[model samples]
Target: MAHQASNIPWNVLASNLHWSELKHPGHGDLHLRFKPDQGKKLHYFVEAFIRNIREHSYTARKQYPEHYNPPLPEEVILDDAVVCKITPTVRRWRAQRKHPGFCRCGSGILRSEETEHKCECPIPIPPEERTAAAFYRRYEPNRCYMFFETNGKAFYNLEIVKTLLLYGEMDTIFRVCAYPGVDLRTWWSMYQCYCENPDAGWDSLCRTALLPYIALNVISCFPETWDSASGKTNEKDYRRMRIYQYMLKHCTKSGMTTEVATHPHRQFFGIADGQFKRYGTEFRGPGLHIPYPYGLMPLEAFLNWDQVVESKPAPADIPQVQWILHSKGLPMELVLEIMAFAGYAPRGRLQVPHDPFHPENREELAKYLRFCWEVLVRCDMMAVALGMAIPWRDLVSNTLVQLLSCVPRRWYTIPDDVDHPESYVFL
Candidate 1:
């Protein structure tokens, strides 16, 4: 009868029994399953199970904040249990799931692990205590760990200590220690003694601080290369020392040796001193010029130019000439002419005959030259090269529409008007 009632298509019984059965697998199954009509009850049972699991996990994390400590290793134990719970279900479903380890709800069960007899309940730890323990581990006393100990004290203080060690200046070290606000006085005194008598204490202080101080420029002193017994300097050390001397000399220099003249309109466009004589506008070199009447080109038209040029037939071995044209907002014909002057070709069949005198294919060459002007104006390269900062989008759109308009009327074929005269429009 219990089993028969469980199978009935209803809600009330489904919620009371089947939901509890799903949560505690160890608890005897209610010998119940949900029918289509009992979906609402089944949903309630699932929701309750999820809510209970989340609450339990949160409670665990709140309990064990110092979970990674050696003796307890609470973090490791909790992690293992979580793996057991989540991994089996994930594998069974053939789906990937991120493991949610430890309860974080402040219930303090973070340190608990289940035993054969029973599961250990959550125990909470104070947040402040955990933070102090972590800090101690990072900044503990060690020669190699200077970065943490110094903790960004003023650069001058660090440099003073570094300089003293490099020059064997023991008395100066003692004098500096007499001043206020310096921590670690014992270590400083020990280091000073080591400098005066090399054999007095362990050589650790000199080894730890000496080389790094020199490398960081805290010590102006340089190491001597001569070996006392051999009476000759080590060649390699001599070479490296000389390099540093050269660097110091150059670092003191004041200004540039020569000045180069540039075009007023373009930042990067400049003529060398010699070339300035021929092209100089006023006294400062050639004026930066834009091929297009306007300042920019359309991005779409630029892309079209790139595609069309790439598609044109050319010799297999010879490199192809590439160009771009742009118009800020002017007629495309003007932009095309500027491109031709700049050495680029415009799209469409060429009217001029191939000039044998020219090394390039004259027809293709003309198109390439026009193309270059198109790219400069359209891409706003002229502005960029000359160091003029202009908005990129407006430049691209204006240039593209202008270039499209410049296409020769003959190049665009209108569909036959016999079929639909209204549909065809000439540019």
Candidate 2:
């Protein structure tokens, strides 16, 4: 005997049989189990989490010595109170003729309000008992809308907000929450540059300095994309290539690679200024424009541009490197050695440094690696090292508390000039 398949549509199946609502079969109604107010539960949990952080902060400041100050309760702000809004994804309204309405006393049938019944059912339904009618009357579903603003408004969905809070950037999160007027995009861009080129400190410095200025200066040069009204387009790749070409000509003082230099935009000739001349015909004469890449410099480039651009210290050499490693609760000595020898800077470089065994290398790379291997791994022995819980995860909370306790409030000082309309930075 052959069986026939059900003629259910995919959209109907998706809506009615949502996996999130159907936790277990034959237990309870799926709709009741996952109500629209579920997001409030998450909001409450985050509130409690912040309370705990505040308590911890207070205790750490009290117990520790001088210069130890926790992040003030006012400084940390996370607003999870999302509004319910009508979403674009709408479906047809359900028919309401099949009524499940019952009397309040559970002893009689409830008809329309005007209709007289044989049973002693009340003429009007109580406000509390009218929920079913209100819920079912709505034609379309509601969606939770989440967003937050900074100096220049930064918006995020549920996943991005949760990820930042749960794993990374607790300080950044709090700082932004507290100071909505601070421009966070530049700081984030700098962080990205750091992640991109961990080993080539000078290269990243130059790139970070130059990119923002270029972004501000050439806002109108890029092509349009997905949403013209919103002014958001997928053009970072095009901008990055343009910046790379500019760097080759001015910063590196080398001819551009064949693939980039010969691209359509490179030879677009125009009248421009020479590098040094400030006066006379040579300064503003008609010539092929070579965008002087060295014009932009990152705020932290303290030494002479020529001196610091090429000979910048590696990340491992920076004093703050240890703080970053410790913040993640990683085995620092081992990780640093591994990082230097293997050239594996997370999000920066892929390979380790070459001179691990050099006598002058006082960083103690090998021994640290051995300690980490034994503490974090070494699964051959049934016995767990460190605590029963994971080492990094266990230490991370304490590390964050420690770091936040000492951090000075600086986000408020960021100038509003970065948020100027001409920059055209879309987060």
Per-residue lDDT of candidate 1, residues 1-427 (tens digit): 1111222222342232221223322221122333554434533432332243334334433433322222221212222333343332222111111112212343322111110111222322223212212112211232532422332222112322332232223323333333333343222222222223221111222222212212112111122222224322333122123222221111111111111101110111111112212111221214524222110122222222212213222232112232233325546677656645654432222222111112233444334323322222221221222233333222222221222222213212235653432222222
Per-residue alpha-carbon lDDT of candidate 2 for residues 284-395, written as tens digits (9 for 90 to 100)? 2145232331212221221122222222233345546656766787887866785566543321110122222223322433332222222212211111110121222212
Please, what is the TM-score per model?
A: 0.12, 0.16
What TM-score does candidate 2 get on C-alpha atoms? 0.16
Query: Which regions in candidate 1 have their CA more than 4 angstroms from the true location?
Result: 1-146, 154-156, 164-172, 179-427
Give the number of the best model, judged by lDDT: 1
Global lDDT of model 2:
0.24
Residue 420 lDDT (model 1)? 31
For all predictions, the C-alpha RMSD in Å is 39.5, 32.5
lDDT of residue 358 for candidate 1: 25
**Poorly placed runs, candidate 2 (over 4 Å):** 1-167, 171-243, 246-286, 293-427
lDDT (Cα, 0-100) at 329 in candidate 1: 57
